[model samples]
Target: MTGVPTGWRNVLPHLDYDLPDDLPPQSSLSGGVKVNLPLELLRQSRSRAGTVEIPGEVLDQYRRYRPTSLWHARDFGEAVGARVPIYVKYEGANISGSHKLNTALAQAYYYRRAGVQEVVTGTGAGQWGTAIAAACAVFGLRCTVFMVGDSLRRKPYRGTIMRLLGATVHSSPSGLTEVAAGAREGASGNSLALAIGEAVEYAATRDRTAFVIGSGETYSILHQTVIGTEAIEQLAARHAEVDAVIGCVGAGSNFGGIAMPFFADAAEGAGPAPLLLAAESSTTPKLTRGVYAYDRTDATGFGPREAMYTVGSEFAIPPAHAAGLRFHGTAKLLSAMRHRDQIAATAVGQVEAMDAARLFAVHENVVPAPESGHALAAAARVATSGVSDREAHHVARRGILVCLSGHGYLDLAAYEEHLTERLRDESPDDDLIKLATTALSAVPIEGGHLRVP
Candidate 1:
């Protein structure tokens, strides 16, 4: 097996601008205070180093599937009519079949060392839940997951996988916690925020269990930097230089994982200085349409008040095959960078994303997860549409590097919908979006809101 990256690259130290501090976790009325983070994770969150050494155990586990293949993707580029060299880093090659496991294993290692016997978290599409469950099993810890209701229905297999991994899974708003039970039924009946709130509440009340996030948070993003670290080395080995780093933005973990190394170079005026681009779903276009604001990280308003580009925690999430991208808020770190022009983001419709995946599958014989398809669509958009409106990102497209966050094998249901042309292409309601965002006025945005160029 190829040697795995021993150190995880840190993105915080590479950024020039400051991401405003989030409000501390509020004391849960029914279940004690919410935050129970591990010490190492908190340290990593505050780290400003170029790289943090991976724990020996975590490094050992990563050997199972580190150095995921970086493909030339010539067939896909030709099919899309791309002129530049196109490459892709496939994160789905791991046993967990997604990038979430990168952080899951690390968190489990830290929590186990910290004497935490159980770990719990919410999942939008089930990948995070499965990763955590598998990690907990490896570390001999108990696991629990709160899955979004819509996703639970659309992808029951995700829940089944978690259960098989020894996780106790509950559908969000399942009456297990007040936060879940009282959550407003939006378009999808449950949002990612609500599921996360339930997990927080569940962890808060339980003894020796901590709520660990898969994405959107700094620590999680740090752990995921292995993706970019490996990609950089592999591309250099192939004598390829990248000018653009693209990935889908589902809380920005996968995007940050693959782009942050290039982002560091851009900040330091070194290397290729690639254009860091994030592709997001139109239905939850926080980076594209929502204002920079301070808002609760969950539906219950009991979690931390995070500074991010948000459509509001209460925004009704549209029911889409890419459940992972249905969250209302972008990651705080990504939002801050976008505001400062260090990163660029664009949103595309479900149909466009799905069609891009179709093109990729036909040419490359590897179906991209519907969430990752957004990045695929953006790559095609850049290749075909030219850099007319994206001057902020870059005009140069020397070589395109796309992060195919996961495999679409388990997401065949979405493909079936796309093939039959029965997939509902739903966009977020403007009126509802306005109504939902109105609550942001209640939160102070002085330090949080940055002017977008």
Candidate 2:
């Protein structure tokens, strides 16, 4: 094995599991159906004692899904005044058109092997739901998705796709309490709903279902390492080097996937460690602008409370155009990366992100999601700054990689709204930030359940 990077050794310490021998071969059942064993055993294994196995078929499917091509945006590089090369790993090309599928597939396979009857999750841009739905269909498992009300209304295609995949989808804030009722009444103004919070609550309350967030669970990040694993191969094939890696920070799954592998390489001194940059919505700047605090995923009704960054500890949030970014805080892995200064966080407003999307379509021929556009905007800002080319170059240096988390096909209406100037630009107000920080500043009482507003 290649030498592990120094930073990774320090960060991850001793490896939790060893790498396995050749992947297990796929098995065929009675009806000529192909079955994966290694992936199942590895995912379902509770021993955590050694390297696990994944069926060769699953690994083959993984290869087909990964090592997604990297693109050199010459025009974008020129537009951004960057003389160096800039490369982006366009993950939107995935089967579900988002990075969520990478984790969803693994989670589904693992859960199915573990005898999980169902999987529950929350989605923002609907990418996560679509991914989970597809995985569930592949594994013949049931999936229930809770979507923010605003997203369900604004992006019906997402819901339709989920249904088509045979998953049940629900809009939060529709019932269950007065808070939900009031929130539903106010939902038409913005598509964001109380679904994610409700989904988490539901999952936590259930015994047969496992709740998966777009971002959460460190194991999820481990699954995403496949992206980095593939990226290393792809970049090397191109005889190129990455100076940095950038991706939007909604739930941070995509960001973590690509960054962690490189981090592993850096830990072992395999090569130069690329800087990790995470872009978030200015309107929902959980890491860059928000403080470290305990905040519920949704505040419309009493819901499962998870520690996250918050804009308002008590105030329920209105929906924003970047539906995927309406969350209140950062994931533990992301928080750890930030606290260690291994990753830098930046905030981009809706307008700027939309503009970046437009530029991407025009110059790159791919329409990026608003969340991805946020990263594009950050890349643009960093590239265009008057900093020395080398300095700036290193920031988003040519060969820099960006995770195209998802496509905007389902979000065409959002594109239209943006084109028509119907989408408003917003950033967190100082008072709101201060209020949220104040509310989260006090440490939560351990083992005391949160009392959702």
Candidate 3:
């Protein structure tokens, strides 16, 4: 794989901004108190070096499933009656059944080298937890995952898998930690923000334990570059070019991994930049309707503030079938790009996404995770709309590459709800959104565009 494009850091100066010298002094209540954001991690995340070398140990693990297949979805295209071809990189082929493993192993390796004895983390749909658990098993470290309670209940087998991998799992807000204790005073259901708070608290209180984030970090996103790097090479071998690259955006890991390399190509004037499209849940349409502002990454107000499109860290999101996409904020890099109109985004309702997933399953013979279904739904929209007319003159053939981030075998319960027409699209109340906006305004930050009223 050709490493990240040389000088890619120069493409987005805003994203590569200098780290805040006045970071809050380390404290248990503050974000990154016990586990500070390592300078090396930040540097690597924003480095322009063309090809950060993968460690031999990490490469050894990657050999088990490094080069995931990029398949031409001719059958799906035919089913959708698309005039152009469609391609998909199936990330579910791995043992963990998702792309989460790509970054998990890298993070586990780093923590192991740092002499961390245990890693605490949060998971939305259990994929990240399962991946980390497997990585920890490989590295001989202990793992504790605070899983979203609703998801844990819905996908019980995922927790079982984590246990089998020797990771301890708990339901978020389970009265096990101080953060969860506080969270339970007001709310009870699982949310990404709540789980993060618990995980951070767990890490902060322990020695030789570090908090590992699943997404919304530079390091994690960089590790995910493997996806895009591999896809670019696979596409080159077939002498094909994509007109658009689409992926579902929960925390933007998979999407960023697959799209950043192409973004680098665009930066270098190598070729026209493929249209970058992010599909988000209408239930928590952070990209579509949230404000672009400096906000905390977790519900408990821990961690360095980042500039991103957000629905407020404290905003109570309604439960949706696609639990993974229920995050309150987009990744900072993706947020910056969207703010500058460098990429496009759309929100899809749960029913619409489920319908698209069913159609795809009929043709492709794979049930997509609810989160991945968003991208499939978006791709179907593009194919049927004949949106290629705008760029038809510039390119002879129109093509789309959608990242099927994971399989839905473990999410059959969600499908059952959808099939029974019992699934409901639950959006946060307007009043709650207003409350969140007001709370966010209290934070003193400069250079943020607060679009929310």
Q: Which candidate tops lDDT?
A: 1
Clashing pairs for predicted structure model 1, backbone only: none
Tell me the TM-score of model 3: 0.90
Weakest 10 consecutive residues of candidate 1 by summed lDDT: 387-396
Candidate 2 regions with alpha-carbon error over 4 angstroms: 1-11, 14-60, 176-193, 204-207, 297-308, 312-315, 386-398, 441-453
Top TM-score hit:
1
Better of 1 and 3 by TM-score: 1
Measured on C-alpha atoms, candidate 3 has an lDDT of 0.78
Q: Please give the ranking of all candidate structures by lDDT, highest first, separated by commas.
A: 1, 3, 2
Q: Report the Cα lDDT for candidate 2.
A: 0.64
Q: Which stretches of candidate 3 lie over 4 Å from their true place?
A: 1-39, 184-187, 386-397, 429-431, 441-448
lDDT (C-alpha) at residue 259 in model 1:
89
Q: Residue-wise lDDT of candidate 3 within 172-277, one digit each (tens)?
A: 8768776676674445465898898788888888778988987777667777878887888888888887888889998899888888878877766778888888
lDDT of 2 at 39: 45
List runs of model 1 lying over 4 Å from the truth: 24-27, 186-188, 387-396, 441-453
Q: Rank candidates by TM-score, best first.
A: 1, 3, 2
Per-candidate TM-score against the hidden true structure: 0.94, 0.80, 0.90
